[model samples]
Target: MSRSDEEDDDEDFQAESNAEEVSAAYKLFTHGAAGPITLGHLRRVAKELREDVPDEVLKDMIIEANGGVKGQEKDVGGVSLEDFESVMKRAGLSFG
Candidate 1:
């Protein structure tokens, strides 16, 4: 039994969508982690995204996500889950 081309295309699209979701989660976590996530987590995710995003872009994202203050440190900086949701809504992203 073999699958059809349409099946393969559907599978590929689904896989790509899943990958995008993973990437989005990493981006969101890197930007909005309150405490459960750590520096190591951000470093790993940033390393993964390096192949796709430029270093300067990531720096800018970090700065923007951190409320315009650069390198405030996580202990003193973070977006609450409620606030994260609000920001996401403002940015046209939605959460279930």
Candidate 2:
């Protein structure tokens, strides 16, 4: 079935938001010596974001964006640059 114009607009907005989030993620990584970002970093970035996204939501977004993993909490194995980018692209955020 074809999508309505409003649906299409929403999709476009989502895409834009994702890009902004990705940019923010990258900036965080760079700020931290251009290294991979840890879950801690993600939390900090999320909190720094313009929108006040809850910790639970951020955690869920991280898991979902990176694909489910076992024992991810306290893993401390920072996400690779590529993975970080991918997660931001898949999350609900905006750079503006």
**TM-scores of all candidate predictions against the true structure:** 0.37, 0.43
lDDT of 1 by residue, 8-88 (tens): 777788767755664456456656444423334555666767755554555555445556543345342333344444455
Candidate 2 C-alpha lDDT tens digits along 1-96: 457988878878887777666766577655746655556666667666766777666667556645655344565345555666665445544322
Error of 2 at 65 (Å): 2.4
Off by over 4 Å in 2: 1-30, 70-78, 87-96
Residue 89 of model 2, lDDT score: 44
Model 2 C-alpha lDDT versus the unseen true structure = 0.61
Count the clashes in each prediction.
Answer: 0, 0
**Model 2 TM-score relative to the real fold:** 0.43
